[model samples]
Each structure stands twice: as C-alpha cells, then as structure tokens.
Target: MLSEVYPFQETAEAARRVQLNDHLGELGVLCLAPSPGLGVTDATLRSRIGEDRITSLMAA
Candidate 1:
C-alpha cells in the first residue's frame, strides 16, 4: 500500500538513496511525522514515479 503510493526507480543506488531520503525528509517535515517509518521507506516507496524529479516538485 505504501509502496504503491511511493514507488521506486531502477537508477543507481546512491542516486536513488539520496533522492528518496530527500523526498522522505520533505514529506516527513511537512506531515510532521516522528520518522519515515513503514509509511515512508526505500522499500516501501521503491516504485512510485516523480520521486526522482523532486527538484521541480520542490521548486513548485
């Protein structure tokens, strides 16, 4: 369920980790979640789109 909402990409692991961490960080701060738990983890969100395109999304 969480993975469906935040899928992952097949990009380099480093790049994926950085982008995912940033995205989850932003979402965590926005939602004020204690932490990026099962609701927001690499495995949980390793299939969603637009996660790598966070620069554009954040600017907007």
Candidate 2:
C-alpha cells in the first residue's frame, strides 16, 4: 500500500525508508487491535501520514 502512493526513487534503501506519509499513501482501511491474552511486549512505531498531509490530499 505504501509502495505505490509515495515514490521513493532517490535512495538505495527505498523499501526500508518508504512510508505512508502521503494522503493516498495508505489507501485502505487499517485497524489496530490488541491480541487476546497477549500481554507482552515492546514495539517500534512509525508514523504513516501526518495530519497536514491528509488535509492537503483531501483538498487536492
């Protein structure tokens, strides 16, 4: 999903650096839910799209 909308054409680590930070970047529904009976853990979080980006995309 994040692959198409944002074109990371200038880096060697394009796949690793690409993010859904554009308005249409993550063009699908996504939900975050906790796993049942799973209490543990640490996670690395990344920001997909910022509020400004969404607003800009919508206005376009």
Poorest lDDT segment (10 consecutive residues) of candidate 1:
1-10
Per-model CA lDDT versus the true structure: 0.35, 0.29
Q: lDDT, candidate 2, residue 16?
A: 43
The RMSD of every model to the true structure, in order and in angstroms, is 15.1, 12.7
Writing each residue's lDDT as its tens digit, candidate 2 over 1-60 gives 332322233233333444634344433211222222222222322134433333212111
TM-score of 2: 0.14
TM-score for every candidate vs. truth? 0.20, 0.14
Q: For model 1, what is the error of residue 3's alpha carbon versus the real structure, in angstroms, after optimal superposition?
A: 29
Candidate 1 local lDDT, 1-60, one digit each (tens): 122122233235435555767443322122322333433345445456445632322211
Model 2 CA deviation exceeding 4 Å by range: 1-47, 56-60
Q: What is the lDDT of residue 14 in candidate 1?
A: 36
Best by the TM-score measure: 1
